[model samples]
Each structure stands twice: as C-alpha cells, then as structure tokens.
Target chain A: MNWNGIAAIWRFEMARFFRSIIQSIVSPVLSTSLYFVVFGAAIGSRIPEVEGVSYGAFIVPGLIMLTVLQQAIQNAGFGIYFPKFIGTIFEVLSAPLSAFEIVIGYVGAAAVKALLIGCIILGTSFFFVDITIQHPVWMIAFLLLTSISFALLGFILGIWARNFEQLNLVPLLVVTPLVFLGGSFYSITMLPPIWQTISMFNPVLYLVSGFRWSFFGMADVPVAASLAAILLFTALCLGVVWWMFRTGYRLKS
Target chain B: MSAIVQVNGLNKTYDGGFEALKNVSLDIREGEILALLGPNGAGKTTLISTICGITQPTSGAITVGGHDVIDDWRAARKLIGLVPQEINLEPFELVANTVRFSRGLFDRQRNDAFVDQVLKDLSLFEKKDNRIAELSGGMKRRVLIAKALAHEPRVLFLDEPTAGVDVELRRDMWALVERLRADGVTIILTTHYIEEAEAIADRVGVIRGGELLLVEDKARLMSRLGQKELRIELRDGVEALPDALAGFDLTLSDDKRSLLYTYKTGEERTGITRLLSAIQDAGLTLADLQTRESSLEDIFVGLVHTEEGEPS
Candidate 1:
C-alpha cells in the first residue's frame, strides 16, 4: 500500500532513463530503421508479398516485437543489476516497501520504457512501409503484455546474474536467437512441415504470431492459441518472480 | 527511557556455514546513544543489516517501536533509518534528489524544505545540485547521513560512520549525533575505533567471533574493570626492588629509578598509602609521583585477548 514508495522507485528509474534520453530513444529507432532498409527495401522487392500483405509491411510488427523484447529485458535487467553492482540496493531492501510494490515499481518503469521504444518503432515503420492495424486495441494489449512479461523476466535475470557478462548472457544467446528463428521476419508457414512443427516449441513464435495477427488479421497460429501462449508465458514469469522474492534468492542471505 | 528497539535471540548462519551472529540480544533505549565496539568481521554490519530488514535472520525476533521487523516490516521499517558501512550512491543522481528519493522510499511526502534543511545540516547544501560523483569522499559520507536522516525515523543505525573520514569530519559527525540525540532520536553506531565509543556512547557493547562479550553503561564498564597505575620516581637509582616493597604489588623500572604500583579503581583500598610507607621505610626517597588511568582501548584489548585465551 506504499504508493509513494512505488512512485519513488518508478520516478527514480525513469529519471535515469531520461538522463540518457537521446541514447535510449535513438539507438533502437536507428536499429529498427536499419532492419527496414535491409529487409523491407532490399529483400521485400524480391518477395513482392506474403499472405496478401507487402513483405515490408509484414515485418513491421515483427520488428517492433524484436525491439520491444530486447529493450525490455535490457532496461529492466540493468535497472536492478546496476543497484546490486554498486551496493545501493541496500536502500531499497531497507525501505518500507513490500516485494510486490518493489516489483511493480521496477517492472512497471521497465515496461513503460519498452512500450515507448515499441511505439517509436511503430511510428518509424510508417516512414518505411505502408501499414494498417486491423486491431489497434489488440496490438496495444499485446505490446503491453509482452513488455510486462519480458521485464519481469529481466528482473529475474538481474537478480540471478553475478556479473555484466552473465547479465547479457540470456538476452544475447537465448532471446535474440529465439526471436530471429521464431519468424520475426518471415512467416512460420513458409517453413517446411518438419521445421514448422519444431517451431511450435519456440515460445517467441506465438508472441510474434499473435502480435502480427493484430496487424494483418492473419496469423500462423490460431488467435486463441497465441493469446493462451502469451498469457501462460506471463504467468510463468510472474511465478518465478514471486518465488525469487519469497525465498530472497540472490537478494538476501 | 523505554526501549525503542529490541533484538532477541538473533542468529544468522550463512550458506557456507559461517555464523555471522549468535543469539545476540539488545535493547536500545529511546533517545540514547549506544555504540557497538568490535574488531573487523565482528558481526557489527551484519547485526545492523538484520535489524534494518536487509538480511533475514535465521532465528530471532527484532522489533522497532513495538512492530516486528519481519512480520510487520512496513511499520517497523518506518521507525528506523540506516546509514550503511559502504559509501554506495547513485553516481549520476544529484545530491538533493538522492535525499528526496530516500524520503519517498520511506513513504514520506515530498518535503523539499526538509530535504534542504537536512542537506544544510550535513553541510552539503552547496553541493546539492551536483552529482554524487562530483563530491569528495567526506562529502559522500555526509550525503549518506543526510539520506538516512531524510525520513526522520525514531531509531537510526550508523554502521562505521566515521571509518575513513578526516578528523574534522569525524568531530562534525559526533556533534551531529549529539544533536540528533537531543532531538530524541535513539542511535546505534558500530565502530572499531574504541575512542569513538569512549567519546560518544552512553553505553558500549563489545563483540568478537560473532558473540557479544558484554554491554554496559560506559562509565560503569570503565570503573568496574578499569585499573590505575601509580608511578613513584625515586631520587636515586638502585640495583633491585627492596624486600620491603616486594610484599606490595610493585615492580621497579629497569633503571630502578621508579616503582610502579597497580590497583583496581573499584577496590576500597588501593594500598597506595602502605606502599609509599613501605618504600620510605626501605630507605627510598621519592622525587615525584604520577598516576594514570586505563583507557577503554586498554580494557577492550584485555577483554578480547582474554576471550581468545591469550595473556592480557
């Protein structure tokens, strides 16, 4: 019930983000624009269209997903990790805030950061390709849900990591590859039957499919299945976070 | 004064089987200064951290202002502020914002005026707009104090607050502690500097090997265990101590120019009169006499050495 405490943490984190506003906003925008130039301009010209949507427009949601996923994990991971690294976490630990409030503050700010980057990339996509959102509300929901979920995962990573290298380990080696292989640029339907079957195991595939469905109204997986996948994934992340705080894992001895 | 902070049967055993605390019990009276004196790795920081709810106790109960530190942490924590041993600050954050942030974290309203006053009190008002990284080491320690005081808690724990600071800053900190005590804030500080405890603490506690050896009123602890030495300088040198003075608890200096007599301060009779008479009868003429009292450091060293089974 410590609303002020939660707001304090949120404001403190947002202040840090604002301090590096230029770098935070510009890096992802520039990177997403590059993907548009490389995949939308050069590759889309050869492909023409996939499932009645232009190849360039097809990758827009996927590109936003990619950027949102990476930024969310990175922002939230570094948000908590930096405090641990410098020993300032003692302040938070000693405060009159609850674990739930702490999570709400850290994860909430991180989600907001990821959503900002996602929206900016969405705006940047307008300049690169002609796009229409058939389900704008669903798109926002998907974006918000994904940001919160990934930020929670990032919070876990932050607590678990002992060093900078370990902090970057999962996001780099595990997440980026999963996003790329999960059909960020191409539809899973384009793959062979065997590959498509294997792609079902990749959780990122469902997130991208559901997010893309909100844009094109066509998805590789059924809308309900994609929705279920994302909801289940969010619950899983929440459970892990709850467990972490409950046991004081890596946070208290 | 009533006990504002109470710790009972506290124990902390880390995963590696290292016991940081063992059945530590204490009661800090409201509006008094209690100093915990110990050597390095003596559970001082760990004890503070546990009471502040930064570390979970394996088995214990700690209550601040009648609220349990674990179960009712929100209320318990509202009554406490902690200045940790490390100088940890957000390097990029402005000094004023840093203090404000701590206040907010404790669920206090945004009181810019109060925050400014705290900064001024710590002599950090001039650097309030600067980033923490821009300040010197002493200033950073001041900022830590300001942050801890920002929330205006009833109990404050200062863990080695003057470890590396210069003499002037140390004196300033002592003065600040006195001012806070006058304002009715109970304070507990941990330090290895026996002089710091001697100068400021109303009561002193000594810990070693994760065990609290004792806690008592500063003056009482000194008087109860303290020893005094009387030195009698002779007019002439001698080869050895005379038989007349041998019966007394006395030793001659290597040059035989002086005799040293040791006695407890609590003793009803120091035997000084008898010793002087014996020296006179032994045909020794006194040139001058001097007496010295043992310091807290001396008593601390003796206690620790005795605990370690070493000669004191």
Candidate 2:
C-alpha cells in the first residue's frame, strides 16, 4: 500500500546517499581498506593462520561484519535523526504514510548502503589476502539479514536519541567495541575457556562467526546457532520498531 | 457551499496536563478563506496540527471530506495540504525535487506538468535546480508553499505563512492565496497579524487561551463589534469641563484642546447628532471634527485582553 510514498522516501534517501559520495560510500571503503592494511599487515605476520585459514583471510568477515553493523546503524540513525533534528521529519509525518512504510524507506535505503560498503570491502579484501567462499548463498543471506537487522536497530536509535551525542553513543561506544572484542581480529579459541564462554554472550560474535563460516566453512559456533541468533535479534528489533510506531514514541510529538 | 472539513468537540491536553484546546468545533465551507487569529500560546498551531493528523487529540473527532481523520486517515489526508509555521526543507535537496517528492508521498501519479506549474506559481522555477541551502529565506518559504500545493489537495492549511517575510513576498503570497481561492480550494490559515485576516480572510475566528471566542463573517464581525470615535478639536484650551457637555460620555484631552467621544457603530442612534448639538448649545467653537472606525486589531486586542480578565 502507498507504494508511491514508500518509493518517494526511499528514492529521496538514496539520492542523499549518492550526493554525499565521499562520506557515505567512499569513506567506508577507504577506512576498511586501512583496517585490512593495519590488521592484515601488523597481526598477520606473527599469527599466520587460524583454524587452517590465513590470518588475513580469517579477518575479512570480521572486518565486513564490523563495518556493516556499524554503518547500517549509523547510516539509518543519522538518516532519521537529522530530519528530526532540523524538523524536516514533519514532512514525512504529515504525509499519507504509515509507520511501516516510513521504516521500510529509511531502513531499506540504509541497509542497502551498508551492503554496498560490505561488498566493496569484500572486493578489496581479495587484494590483501587469499579468500574463498564455501557457501556463497549463505554469505549473501547473512549479509542481507544482518544489514537489515542492524539498520532497524539504527532506526530505533534515531527515534530514541534526543541529541547528537546520544545518536553516536551506541554505535561508537557500544557497537564498535563489541565488534573488536567479538573476534574481528582473532579466533575466540585463543581466549581462555571462561573468556570464550563470556565472548559467546556478545551478539556480534555470532554474526562474525556465521559470516566467517560461509567463507571458510569453519566457525566458532554452529551455523544454525548463528542463524538463530540473527533471526531472534531481528524479531526483537522488529518488535521494538512496531511498538515505536504504534505508540508514536518520539515521532508523533 | 457544503462543509468540507468539520471538527466537533475537539480537545487536546498535552502529556503534562496542559490543555491546548477545549471542546473546539468548526465547519469550514468549501472555497472560503477562514482565518484563525490569536496571540502566541493561543493553541492555533495545535488546532491545525490535530486536523492535519500531526498531533492526536485527547478527545473528540474530526472529518475531512466526510472521511474520519483517524479511521480513514489516508483518505482524509489525501485531500489536505499543510504549510506549517516552521520552514524546514531538506537543505541539500533540489527545490523541484522537494515538490515532486511531496506529490509522490501523497501517492499521486507522475505529473511533471503540475509540479512545474506549482514551481512557476511560487516563482521558484528559476531556482528549481538549486539546493535549498543556497536559496534565500523568502525563496525557502515559497518552496514550502509549493511543496504543500504539489498534490493538488482540496483543502489547504497555511499556519502563519507570512510571519516574517518581506512585503513583496507577503503580497505575492496573498495573491497566490487569492488565486487558490478562485480555483475552489478551501483555505484555513492561522495568524496573529490582524491586518492579514482583515485583508484576505472571508471569515475570522478569534482564539485566545485555547478557546475560540468567535467565528463570524469578516464583514459581519467588523460591523457587529465595530466601534466609532468622534474627535472634536476646540478653538481654544479650557481649564475645566463645560457643564453643558456633562450629560455626554466624553473625555477631554490633557491639554483640553479636543474632546473624544466613543460610540457603537451598530446602534441606530450613534448619539453623534446629540453630542454635536450639545457642543453647539454649550457655545463651543469646533476647529475640526473627525470620525474614525475601529480596526480588527482593536477588537482582537479587546477580545484577548478581556478574556484574560484584564481591562481593555
């Protein structure tokens, strides 16, 4: 329903994405390339391999997940937050649009932006390291679902944040740190048994493990478990989004 | 003319228990400009917001074109366009794209011709390709109006459309409003500028402290509450009031050079004849005499001030 409205919002967001080509599309590609250079060069020399995979290749999914998760959230969070900040959100609120359609437009475009960055990083990783995909379909599936889920999370953050500081609080303070600690650079097996148990509690660990499995066919957790984690988290994010719209939490006011 | 938008017993109390509206009711006839005049904090914006579905009412109901604003919001909203008080446009978006995007949001089919016309009408066609950040303040306000009109709605709400614009743009906006009226669009605008209401509004509603004191035809309200003043300049200064004029309700100027007589215009007997006769009988020589009618501004100030329990 209201496909025109949805498309208008989506297209407007995408246009904005392209307009800021350096910040939106190029920065992630360049920064993640630096991650490859720093992590692959400095760390790969000593620890040549982990689980029979090169240290350089092993970190590819971790890097992709790290960037994808943060970008998805940041892109969407800023997407909605800026409009609300400058008061342009009233245009969308007064339009003949449902909450679901609004979410789809902003989150959908944000997820797509994150996916573009993820795919670019994947392409750029081939230059620094040797890599293979044992399950290309699963890689794509995980890429899509993870992008959408994190984008939804970002959408919620956008609405909940009242100021600019709060907008970046979660992605910078919470998500980036979790990505680093969630096995982005090294395997969890190298950790002490107690730390490994605790690391499993980190949601980002499941995403990286599952994504890594799709490439190397070796993972820290069962593929089914990772899939279940993503699905469950997605459901939770969806529930929150639905509740936000239903109550008009920060939007209606 | 049939009622295009009807609001009945509408009430809005904010989360902190501040009541912004109280049992407000109104019927907007098709193709008439209704001006809601009120001072700041008078709930004018709240009333417009509730009808546009931007703010939910705590109680009561509203319908636009016979569609309930709540249950059939999509249908109701399609017929309404709002130019809000705030001028908030995407700074980076192109001007033309802004209007097109708004049309698309209304589910309107592609109509470049219509968008083009709206831009042209708002005198923004030349700046269509420029980003909003580059446009001047007057141009930005025009962009807001163009965006509101892009979908060709049956009813349009302009909330303080000419609040801080230059005289040229204000006149341009007023001309545009008149053009829209000629095209059969029902217009509802809220403003504190009494002159604006007097100039363009077919009907005027005075609102104060979340209460609508009156809604009447502009001409009728002016005549019904309109008062006249008679100023009689004396040939010389007087130290004291004349005993012959003691029967009249009159005030002598501090210098005692003139006398001011206030009377209702609606009364058949304005007492002007008697007052003039009294002045003549008192052997007062009048140097000059003038009669002036009160403006809507006076009536508005009177209404809002009196409602606040203050002397007007």
Candidate 3:
C-alpha cells in the first residue's frame, strides 16, 4: 500500500542494475548473437527450415525465452541474495514496507530487467534472419508473464539459498538443461514418438511452444495449455512467497 | 514522563533451543537516553531486534507508542528507527539516494529538504553523491545513522553504534547522540563500554545470561554501588595485624608496609571513623592515608562476576 516505499525499493534496485550497465545488457546480447552465429548460420545452413520457417527465425522465440528466463532468475536471485548476504535486508525488514511491497520492488525490477534483455535479443535477431510476429500482443504478453514468473522463482531461490554455490545451483544445473532439451533448436515433432512424449512433460516446452506460437502461429502443444501452465506456475510461486513472508521463513529468524 | 516503549516478559529462544532472552521487561521513557550494557552473546542484539520487529519473540509482548509490535507492526515500526550492528549499505548506491530510499521505505512522504538536513547533521553532505563503497569506515557509520534518522522516527535504536570505531569517531558519535537527545528523540543504545554508558546514558541496563540483572539511573547505580577504599601507610612494617585493628575489615600489604580498608560509600555507618580510631588505639602510626572511590567499570565487573559465579 505504501507506493512511495515500493518506488524507493524499485528505484534503488534499478539504479544498481544501471550501475553496471554494460555487464547487465551486453552479456546476454553477446551470448544470443553467438547463438545466432552457431545455431542460425552454421547449423541452419545444413538442416533446412523446420515447420515451414527458417531454422534461424524459428528459434528466435526459443532464444528469447531462454535468455529471459535465465536473466530473470539470475538477476532477481542475486538481487535479493546479496542484500541478505551483506545484511542490508534489515533495512527493509525494519522499514514500514510490507512483504508484498518488498517482493514487488525486487521482483518487479528483475522482471523489467529481463524484459529489457529480451527486447535487446529480439532486436538482435533481426540482423541474421527475417522474422515477423504472428501476434505481437500475445508475444509481449507471453514475454512479460514468463519474465515475471521466473523472477518470482528467482526470488524464492534467493531466499532458499544459503551460499553462493546453492544460489547458482538451480539456474545452472536444472534450468539450463531443461531449456536445452525443451525443443529450443528443433521442433518436438522431429523427435522420436517416445522422446516427444517425454518432451511434452518438460515445463519449459510449454513456455517455448506458446512463445514460438506467438511468433509463427504454430505450437507443439495447445497454446491454451501453455497459458494455463504459466498461470499455474505464477500462482504457485506467489503462494510460496506469501507463506515465506507470513512465517518469516528464511527471511526472519 | 510517559513511557515511549513498553515490553512485558519478552522471551526469545532460537530454533535450536538456545534462549537468547528470558523474561525481559523494560519501560523506556520518552526523550530519555538508555543504554544496555552486556558482553558478546549476551543477547543485546536479540533484545533490540525483538523490539524492532526484525526477530519474532517466542513469548511475551512489546508495544511502541502504545501500538502492539506483533499485531500492529506497521504502525509500530513507523514510530521507530534502527541502526543495526552490521554496517550494510548498497555499495553501488549514492549516499544521498541511500538515505532518501531508506526514508521512503518508511512510507514517509518525499522530503528532500529533510534528507539534506540529515546529511548535513551527520556531516555527510559532501559525500552525498559519492558511492558508499568509496566512503571510509567512519563515514559509512555516519551514513547508517543518517539513514536511520531519515524517517525522523520518534524512537531510535542504535545497537553498538560505536563498535570498531576510532576514539575520535566514537567521540563524534556520542556528540551526535547527545544532539539527537537534545532534539527530543528517545534513544536506546547497546554497548559493552562502561564509559560509553557513563558518558551518555541517563540510565543503564545490565544484561547477562539472557537476563536483565539491573536497570537503574546511571547516577544512582554508580552512587549506590560505589565503595570507598582507604589505604593507610605504616611507618614500620608489621609482622601481624594488631588485636585492636581486628574490629575493622583490614588487610596488610604483602610487604607489610601498608594496610587497606574497604567500606561502602552509601551505608550510613561507613565504619571509617571506628576503623581509624581503632588503628590509633592499636598504636599503629599512620604515615599517610588515601581514599579512592570505585568507578562504574569496577561496579560493572563486580556485577557480572558475581552473577557468573552463582548458580543459574
């Protein structure tokens, strides 16, 4: 309810993001560009197009999703964790701000940062391949929702982690593997029937499929399922965060 | 004077069953400076944390300005500010922005003028635009004080405000605390330095083993516990104490060149007159006599040692 408190926290976090502007923006852009070179130029030349779209253009949504998800989690995770690590979290805890405001401030800033990185990658995609969005609104919608949900997950991760190794554990080990195996480079239909069935269960697949559908109007699974999956994940994360603040779990001792 | 903060039977036991605080109760008068003195792991921080609502109490209740800390935390928190033991600030953020942001966190309306004044008060105006990382340890501590004062809360909790600071900075901090007190802010500080409490606190609270042993006016505590020592020098060394001087609590020096007598300053019957008359009657000629009163440090050491020696 304290709008000023929210803005103050939001602004402070965003200022920290801008303090290391190049590192925040360039790392993702450069990695996405490399992906374009290796996957779009090198592989697309021999593999041909998938789903009637060039391999380079078809993977754009997947690449954006991959970058957004990683950045959201990484940025948000480090954001909250650093405060706890250095003990500045007391400033927030002692303030008049509620847990909801604290979340909105931190997660909100992380989502915005991820969204900005996603746009930069989206722009980078234009140089190597001709791409068009079938549904610009849905594309943005999916982009925002995905960024927010992952940022929420990152917030939880930040609180849950006790050390540096634990903080990076989920994103580096679990999320990266799921993204790679979730049809980021090729269509799920290209896989064997059994592998395709397994791929259907990968949560990242629905995120990528729905996002890709917004760009190419084609999806491996029903678009509604993708939307439902994201909504459910968001709700679950919110529920966990609410409980965290309520019980002072990990945050208060 | 009215009490600004009231705690009734506050207790805190960690998850591992370590009781950090036990049946702690206090009343902090408005506009008064109170100091909690304790050694490391004596639960000084825990008591402050519990009152500030950063840590939950296992049992008991605390109210600030008549608002319950548990049920109405938001309102209660708005009335208080805390400068924790840790020196934590966003290293990348500007000092001015840091204070401003801290104020905003309290839901206080934007008052850049007030922020500027706080920086000025703390002599942090020159470093306003500088990043916290660039500031020295002393300056960083000042920034912490500035940040706490940004919201202009009625009560301020400074936990170890002078810990790890140089003597000069510590002096400056004490002066700042005095200034804050002059401005009608109720301040509660925790420290292990007896001199700090003797210098700045109107009242002092002693805690040990998760319990408050005493809370009394600083002047009264010192005077009531103060004991005077009388050192009497003898012209000739004595192989043994004379029977006439046996009525007094006296001890001879190892060299047998002097005798020592200790008596309470507060007691009506100090026994000093009787002891001196006994010494004269014993034909023990006194070459010199010197009297000394105990300091707060002596009393503090005695208090802690006595409690530590007893059964829990």
- Over B1-312, each residue of candidate 1 has an lDDT whose tens digit, in order, gives 899989999999998999999999998899989999999999999999999999899998999999999889999999899998899999999999999999999999989999999999999999999999999999999999999999999899999999999999999999999999999999999999999999999999999888888999999999998999899999998888887777887788888898888899999998988888888899989999999999999889988988997655
Q: Which residue pairs in candidate 2 collide?
A: none
Provide the clashing-pair count of each candidate structure.
0, 0, 0
Which runs in model 3 stand beyond 4 Å of their true positions? B233-241, B253-258, B284-288, B309-312
Each model's lDDT: 0.93, 0.92, 0.93
Badly placed stretches (over 4 Å) of model 2 are B310-312
* TM-score of model 3 vs. true structure: 0.96
On the 0 to 100 scale, the lDDT of residue B192 in model 2 is: 91
Query: What order do candidates take by lDDT, descending?
Result: 1, 3, 2
Q: lDDT per residue, candidate 1, A18-40, as tens digits?
A: 99998799999999999999999
How close is every model to the real structure, measured as TM-score?
0.97, 0.97, 0.96
Candidate ordering by DockQ (highest first)? 1, 3, 2
Q: Grade the docking of candidate 3.
A: high
Candidate 1: misplaced stretches above 4 Å? B254-256, B309-312
Worst 10 residues of 3 chain B by lDDT: B240-249
| lDDT at A247, model 3 | 95
lDDT of 3 by residue, B266-303 (tens): 99998888888888888888899999988788899988
Residue-level lDDT tens digits of model 3 in A201-239? 899999999999999999999999999999999999999
The candidates' DockQ values read 0.85, 0.78, 0.81
